[model samples]
Target chain A: MENIHLENIDFEYAPGRRIFSGAAVDINQGELVLLCGKTGSGKSTLLRLIQKELDTKAGFVMQNPDNQIVCDRVYSELEFGATNATQGNERHRLELIRQRVAETAGYFGISRQINRDTHTLSGGEKQILNIASAMAANPKVLLMDEPTSMLDPIMADRVIDLVKNINRELGITVIIAEHRSDRIFAYADKILLIEDETVVCKDKRSMAEYMSRSQELRGFLPEIARSVEMSPPPLSLAEAVFGKAHAVYVGKEAPLSSHPVLRLKNVSFAYDRSKGALIDNLNLSVDGGSITALLGENGCGKSTLALLSAGALKPYSGSVKINGRKIKKAGENSAMLFQDVTLHFTGDTVDGKYNGMHPYDLSGGERQLAALDIILSKNPSLLILDEPTKGLDYNEKEKLGKRLEKLRDEGKAILLITHDVEFAAMFSDRMLLMFGGKIVCDRPAREFCESNIFYTTAGARLSKMNSD
Target chain B: MRRFENFNPATLLIYYMTVIIPIMVFMNPFIILTALAAGLVRAGIYERKIPVKRILFSAVLTAVMALVNGLLSHQGDTELFFINDRAVTLEAIRYGAVNGLMLAAAIVWFSAFSRTLTGEKIMALLWHLPKLALLISMIMRLIPRYLERYNKTGLAARINEERGQVPEKKHIMQITSAVFTWALENSMDTADSMIMRGYTSGGKRISGIQFRPGDAAVLALTAALQTMYFLPETWHGILMAVLCFLPEIYRIKENVKWKIYTLKI
Candidate 1:
């Protein structure tokens, strides 16, 4: 059964500024579709078009989990859609709505937070609530735009798993647009590629093959699919084990510098006096001419450590020294770039090229680079970035990686806090995993990734399984 | 307390009105004292601890109001003292004290009312007016989100200032403008989400609270007790006390019933 059919759909933001032209897609019932494109490539616009085309009820979940939520409390948000759909305030109808809310909450494992304030939930929990609320209406189709783009790896995986479960178990058609396709690609029954005012829909295997042939779109493929050299490339790590292992390049370790750029000596910090220290006696050093990646779970002190090293936060006991000089204030010797790049902008124009344009007018990747430019103007020897790859596409990440490498070559120590293992492996010279308020593992990026089990990238895991 | 909170929002709304309206309308000293006592006890029970700071603040505020009124108005017969060549009479002081006590009682009752009728309950009560209820809900959700954005933007602006960018006093204006732009942009997405979820379907809202027989009983009792204010001053105070402490009495009854039931088990 055809759940959604879009034929020769035309869309444009303004005259001659077209997003999609002669674009068509046919999605069947119970099928999970993946939408992939570059930043500002009309992924969200395409999802909105699909929503508009559907005559039946369709649930829509967008990025930025905070905005989509309309109710103050979790239970209210869950039943918001159903209450808005039902015609009257009849007792039986209200009871049915309550039952649907309860069932959706239980299915999504959000029953524990059923009474919590929607604003109090974490980004991941908020996104889950959005999904549950959308599902509460009992819609025939669900459309999510970059659902996991703002989440950590664990939370992102949990959301993707729930999405997959909703598609498989509930028999509802799911169409999701995501930049982080590595986690969701394998479960997609059909892949929709949007580029240059056109939409190409193909089955998963054919999409993999098609992506492999297109150099620009190849980055959209899963790491396992990209690593395997097969007729129809394997979509998952388990299937890639049967294929031949590709030769992986591990970069040579850089020589340690005697004078480190950013040094944290026995740092211990806690936000609350009653609670344990978030960063307890943690020591780390990032040398000039090297990029260091700090990997950890959300709230495991990666960002706190970055702030400490940047002098934005003071440790309780230890000293943070930039170039062997103790720093007393934030942005004194180190430049820190926050996750939201918009925070870094104070005016309309960042530079001559982006003159007369609002900072928000720029794309996500460009805004990040522009923020980096503003921060770099300080000429600080140490640069600290928190979640730099949060909402960027592959191309943007690549651009950011090259820019970081250039900064490293200029003898600026770069400290990157990210959950993207793939970006860390591909760019950072050193990898440090923080757990339990301490750095548990510190080594060269490739060596560190190759040795770890769960923390490693899909390519590393695939190679490890093949070698096994 | 939980059982009291579980009553239908309509019943709770009516209960609050009946309990508060009489105290507001009748400025009798006995009625004021009874309402104040009940409000303190209810607030204490709901919060799990006596709000000593709130009590102290209210006491200081009432004393200041009484002192100001007594000093400014010297129309009474019995003069306690002369302040700025004007007599401060005992009758004037008493009148001021009563007015202050009335204001204080109203504050306490309203505080208790706010604590009992949370945002959810308020929305539930306003379900008959779906648009207003939704607007209230959206405001409750967005105000916090907007403040968060403002704080984040302020922090970012400070970060920029630390990096050799000397923003003037207009920094606040800059932050506000940025946040406004961000809100406007994100509101589009929120509106799209609302449209997708059938927000334009003109359907009535249905709150999750169920109106049971116990709620009806409480509503009837509240109505009956509130009407006793028309009887006499003494009866008004007595009935008002009963109406105000209804939740506490019900809680004790339920506790005793549970104890006996558990003993039988």
Candidate 2:
């Protein structure tokens, strides 16, 4: 049965700025659907329209998890929806709401944190709590807008797995709009591609075939499908055809100068004196004209090391040298771009057409580029970026990768602290893994990805499987 | 686990009212002293340690108030000394000290009350006024988030100022404006989330607290002891002591029972 049906619906922010005109789509019950598009391409508008149509029967989860939360306590947030839906303060009705909240909390494996304050939860935990609260309403349809765009890979995987379980076990329909489709492509039953004020819905194989033919939308294809040249492209690593597990060259290694641009010797740092050091006696150096990537799990001190290198944070017992001279303050000889690029703008406007508009009004990718432009104007020898690709689409990531490459050609040393393994493998010359305040693995990007099973890309995994 | 925190919000409210009302009504020295002692003990039990800071603050405030009152009011028979030709008497000092003690007892009781009645419990008590309760809850949740964002924006402003992109004098104003804009923008999403969840103004709120038999027993015991306030002064003082330390006595009993059961095992 068709769970959601939108026929000839038109939506627009203003009179002339039409978002979707005569957009029609049908979603079947119990099917997992993936929505793909560029930022500001009406993916969220479509979800909101469907929600407007479905009214109280549909649950909507937005990108920013912090904004969706309405209650201070976790248990109160869990029952917020049911309480709103219930009419009178009858004993039986409130009891049913409590029971539903308890059951939903158990299903989401969030019972341990049921009584916690909402603000104290981690980003991933907050998103999970949002989903659980949405489910507590027992809606027939769920509409999620880029739910994992702000999460790390591990947390994103957990959320995706939970969504799959919800679709299979309880038979609730899910339509999720996302930027990164590599992890969820295998599980999506149908693919809905929104472009040019129109919506096209296709099955997995047909969507892959169609996306492979289009140049602009081709980046949205899964890595396994994009890498192998075959008819009716595969949706997963298991079904992909691989010839050999050859180590493909990621990029030309930049010639190392005699003196590295940034160096950290025996650096140790801790935000608090009572807790142990977050970065303990770590040593690292990045030469000029090289793009280095630092990869780690959430809260593994990757960002602290980045700050230490950028001279934003001082180590207690070690020296941070830029161009063989110890630096004393932040932005002395290096520039750093924070993960939330919107924070970089303190003015009402940015350069060019973004003038007269607030920085928060721009899209994610545009805001990032504007921040990078400001950082580059300082002419620093070393550049440090923390999670530059967060909340950016595939096209924007490609643009950023090309921009970083251009900077590397100009003899600028770039250090990226990120959770994007695929982008790291595709762009960086060297990949380093940080664990427990130490560099556990450091190698060329190709070798680093090929040797590790869990940290490798979908294409590398497919090739490895074929070789095995 | 906090044992007192598990009681129903209504029971906790009544417990605090019965304990505090008598302290405000009666000016008897015996009643005030017992209430102070019981308030200190109860606050200690809730905090798991002596609230030395609160006690010290109260002591200093009480001493200063007593001194001021004793010197200003010259209505006593037994004059101890003359301060600037104004007599300071023993009876006046005693009266001032009793008033200070009464204020100190009230302070200690209120502190203990605040520690027990957390935001959630207060919301539970205000469930009948759903709109006010939700507004308070959202404010409590969003203020910390806003403060965090403000700090982040300040750090970003500092970074920009270091790069010479932002002027030093204008940065704070810029950050304040930026955060204000960000809050206004994000509030739209918050509103959408509320609408998506089918929220209405007059909807019923569920506090998720169950009124168990233990809650009823505590309420009944508090009501029985509250009647002693109308009795003789001595009886009222003793009963008030018991009333104020009821939660501490319950906590001790539970701890002893668990210790004995574990030993038997």
Candidate 3:
């Protein structure tokens, strides 16, 4: 039976700017529906229409968790929906609400943070709290509008797992609108493609069949699925439609250099003096004309190390040196690009309003490029980027990779701290793996991909699987 | 560190309002002194230590206010000397001192109030008035969020090369303008998110903390103290002074009891 059904729905942002017209959608029980489209293509609007918090028994999670959390504390945020559902006599219902909050938080592995301030939670934890709050409402269907769009790779994967678990355990139908199809496409049962105010719904089999017929839509396929060729692409290498994996290209690594552009010696840092250092006694150097990728789990001090290396943060002990001289001020010899691109825009540019529009109104990829351009205008000897490929599409990621390569060829030292293993594999000359505020391994990018199994790229994984 | 941080916010509101109203009404020298001393103690407790710098700044401010009042208003009987052909009388100085003390006491009490009454506490206390509670919460979030965005905007202005030849003042002005604009625009998203989460959906917001027995006791005590204002001027003034110092007296009694217990052991 269809849990959610919409017939001939018309949605328009303004009189002339029509988004959806005569769109019809039907979602069945226990189905994992995937909503795929370009940005501003009305995916979120459709989800909102379906959820309609006032009328339907549907839970909607927005893109940015920071804006979604309605309460101050974690426990209160989780209870927000349930409290809104209560009719009368809060004293009697609060006990049940508390129990529900505790149970939901425990299910999402956020029970320890129940008493913590919601605003104080990390980005990943905030997204988890958002999902937990939605589930506490006891909705029949859960609709998430790009829930993982603002999260790092680690957090993004965790959110997907939670969605999968909720569907499997509770038998609740789930619909997710996501741009990162590479991360979410595997678990989907049906695919809904929205474009130009039209919605086309299809099962996985028919969707793959359609992809086989159209090359334009093939770009929407996951990277792992694209590694092999067949009538319908495979979700995993183990279940490939093709006979074997294609040959994966590996980039050549640059030679090591003695003269370094930026150097860190015995650097240590701690947010609180009493809790001990988060990054302890780390020493490293980035040679000019090379791309160095720093890889680590979220909250493993990758960003802190990036900031320290960029001279934005001074170490408690030791020093940061640029061109073998002690750094005087931040941004004098370095420029750091943070994960959030919106925080880096100047709101206006010299050239006729920066692409003829405001920075905030631009697309995610455009905003990122604008931010990069702004940073590059400083023309620092060293470029330190923290998760630069966070919200970029495949084409945008390629453009950024080319830009970084050009910078490297210009003898500019680049420190790329990212969760994008594939992008790093394509561009980086060297790779450094950090665990618990310390570098555990440093190797050439090629060797690094060939050595590791889990953290390796999808192309490398497919190659290994085929070779076996 | 605030002694009343986690107490029922309604109780804190009643307690502070009840204490401050009488101090404003009586305006007597003795009553003002008691209120000032109590205000300082409350601020100290909330800060978890003696805020020496703040106290010194308040003293300087009090002196300035007293000096201004003494020079501006010459309504005293006993004239001491003349300053620029104006009578600088002893009675005028004393009256200015009383006014200054009242202003300083109010400032200190408010400082403590701001420290203790966080956004969460205000929301809990004003659940019945949802719009007002939401406005207070939004303002509380706005200040920190604005500061953070302002700092980031400054960094962005530099990266954009907008600050290359501009002076520091111009750079600061540009960054401030950008931050204010962004904050205004971002508020729309915040409002939408709140609405999507079922805010203002004609339902009662169930606060986590309910009114407990101790909260009721606090409310009763504040109510009884408020009634003392109707008593005779001298008698009521003395009661007001004692009420102001009640927290300090309790703390002293508790500390002495603890010290004696330690000595016996």
TM-score list, all predictions = 0.93, 0.93, 0.79
The local lDDT score (0 to 100) that residue A131 gets in candidate 3 is 80
Q: Mark the regions of model 1 whose C-alpha exceeds 4 Å error after superposition.
A: A12-15, A23-25, A228-232, A255-258, A466-468, B43-66, B81-85, B162-167, B226-232
CAPRI tier of model 3? acceptable
Candidate 1 vs candidate 3: the TM-score winner is 1
lDDT of 1 by residue, A1-468 (tens): 447787897888999998877866788999999999888889888888778767337889988888899888898887887776565448888788878888888888999998898899999999999998898888889999989888887888899999999999989999999887777888898899887888889888888888888778878988766555655677776666665655354333554454588888899999998989999998888899989998988889888888778777789998889999998777777888888887777666778567767787898889999999987876889988989999888889999999999998889899999998888888988899999899999998878878999887777776677677
Which scores greater on lDDT, model 2 or model 3?
2
Candidate 1 per-residue lDDT, tens place, B1-265, comes to: 2478788878888888876776678778888888887888778777889978767866876688789889888898888888789999888778777788788888888887787798778787787788898888888889999999999887665544553444565777888888888888789878877878887756567666677999889988887876775787778678878988998888998899889889999
Please compute DockQ, using alpha carbons, for every candidate against the native two-chain complex.
0.56, 0.65, 0.24
Tens-digit lDDT string for candidate 2 (B1-265): 3387689988988899887776777778887888888888777766789979877876886788778889889988999999899899888778888888889998888887888898788888888787898899899899899999999887655544464655766767888888988888889998999889988776778566778998998999998997886888779778888888789778887888889889999
Name the DockQ score for candidate 2.
0.65
Candidate 2, residues A194-281, lDDT tens digits: the string is 8888888888888889998887887788776666676667776656644333333332343344348999999999998898988988
Highest DockQ, which number? 2
Supply candidate 1's per-residue lDDT for A82. 75
lDDT of each: 0.82, 0.83, 0.75
Residue A120 C-alpha lDDT in model 1: 93
